[model samples]
Target chain A: MDNYPYAEQTDNELVRLSLSDPNQFLYLSKRYEDKLLRYITRISKFSRDEAEDVLQEVFIKTYYNLNGFDPDLKFSSWIYRIAHNETISAIRKKVARPTVSLDSEDLKNFTDSFDLSRDLDKSFDRKLINQALSKLDDKYHEVLVLRFLDEKDYVEIADILKKPVSTVGNLILRGKKLFKEEYNKLIINKNTK
Target chain B: MKNKNISQIVLERIKGEKIKPISRRIFYIKKVLFWTVVTLSLIIGSFIFSLILSGLFNNDWDLYDRFGFNFIMKTLPYFWLGSFLIFTILGEYYYRKTLLGHRLRYVIVIGFYMISTIIFGSIFYFVGIGDVLEKSFIDISPVYRNIILNRINFWSQPEEGLLSGIVTKIGNEEIEVKDSNGLIWSVNINGASNRNQVNLFVDEKIKITGDIIDDSLFVADEFRSW
Candidate 1:
């Protein structure tokens, strides 16, 4: 894996270069490829290959619509928005029930966000947290994933989802509360069983 | 396949397939189009709002006392009001299509739209554009006059002592008027009150309230320009 000589360039600068020479788009797409793949896998039931297919489509569409990118917005948000829409469309086409697939790092991020004790048995807590997240509505689950796991702020989440910042704030607050309640309910059910 | 470089693959696919970025002009045109629709909607909404104001201001409020709430309801500019609402919604929709338009809440957008239309509409109203538009619409569509301005139909009842028409001839104490229904009536305005502040002239539309002396004669107690 060679070091990208243009890695230091700003996204806007890269976008400008990409517009002039299609090869410059390599750096831009490479920058978002891993992140978008993880996002697609997190929000949908696609396998890694399927998620990569979606990511490839996202890159192609993003390149095709490069002229439409508003310079006022962060390139990451714009690309993520494209990735999000493509993943959702793919999910709809596949008719697969969408679910969150949290890995170890994502679980740690989620638990750390809520200040849950790290001392707890990791596997059990991971299962409980994943079940709680799965139980949430798509709106709540998406926001929680973006805010806690992806580490996006309210404004970025709002831009990615094309919702109002205030709505994003409210969703995060309500999502956290709902997640805790669901986690507790799951724990109680597990204890009884 | 799992170990393949996706970006490289996508880049090669791009090179092979000859996919090009859509022209910036298309996006520019789309953005301009959305803004154009929004501006046109706002302008049209302001005009419609101005017409609404004109309708309300030009209405005979004194007749409201005699005719009651039904007269007020019948004379309201529902057509203009409906048009204003449609333009307002269209303005909001197109505004949302603009870049960063989604950042604001619907209430904020709608509130801003309402305030803009009100301010500009009032300006249009005070400048008399509203009246001109109303008159033009009336001229263009008789249905508009008959349906929206039912006041015309209400005033055309000669048997009920309410009459309106264009003045065709003037006499020492009488004016020959042609009503909307094409019936000519000789109106005696010798002692009629002009508290309504109407200027009498040939070809002026006038409304009268009084007794019907005969099929072609009406003695008015009050007369006002319509």
Candidate 2:
């Protein structure tokens, strides 16, 4: 795999190459496979197999729409946008509620992002955080996941969601405040119980 | 599932299924089509705006005292106003379909659309397109002249002491005018004030505020060229 060429090429260059040779798309898909798979699982209720199936579709769609890719936008944002749409569509078709399935690393990233690292030391607090996130509105939950776990900038999130940048900024701000309120509510309920 | 390569699998499916990227020309055409709709909406919206201005400006504001507020209501261009609003909304919708269009907020897009319409509409009005368009519509469509331009019907009521028509003949102190309904009335202009300050000539369209002396005669108190 190390001997394979084109690993160092930028996404945009890979896209151009893939347009001429369909096999070159493998490099582009490989680059985004893990990231998009994780994104799909985090933002949806899909099992690992289902998430992988969705990721495969995302890659296929990305290749099928390669001619329509806008040069002005980053390829990463474009691919993420496709992944987000596909996951949401799959969830809708199955009539399943979207749930955030953050791994240990994602949980740590979320806590560190909000300066709640001390709370992460307790295993119970991690469950509470997960429950709180699952309880949030889909709008707030998606933005929080993109901003904190995925570590995307406001502009990138806006591009991925196809929303105005200012709107994305306001959503992130409001999402953080809502997340704190939900987390605190969960802690109080657990103590009372 | 643990060792399977998703990329290789997808690539194999693409090869087997013969899937190809949609042509770049299709996307380009779609973008161009959306922009064309946006442009047409803006232009049509501006023309409708100009027609609205023409209707308002050419309205008989001096008769407000006689006809009261109802006259103002009756003369307003509600049809053009409605059309302008429809086109404005359409312009915003199609503009959003363009690339990078969602980057701007609704307020910004609508505000820009309104400003462009006003600027262009004002230019169209000053260039006399509004008046010409209005006349053409009135000539071609009786529904427009009678219903939409209710001002004409409002003034053609001779028995109610308001009348308008084209001058067919001029006498010493009376003019024979053919009303919108094809009835000719002898308008006695002996003591009538010419508010428009224009000389009355044959085939000139005029509005008269006066009284009905008889079935065929109307004594004018005031008159103006339309």
Residue B10 CA displacement from its true place in model 1, Å: 0.7
- In model 1 chain B, the worst 10-residue window by lDDT is B1-10
On lDDT, the leading prediction is 2
The CA lDDT at A188 in model 1 is 81
lDDT of 2 at A83: 99
**How many Å off is the CA of B44 in candidate 2?**
2.1
RMSD of each: 2.5, 2.7
Clashing pairs in 2: none
Task: Provide the lDDT at B75 for model 1.
Answer: 74
TM-score of each: 0.93, 0.91
lDDT of 1 by residue, A135-185 (tens): 899899899888988899888888899988888899898998898888878
Question: What are the lDDT figures for the candidates, one per model?
Answer: 0.87, 0.88
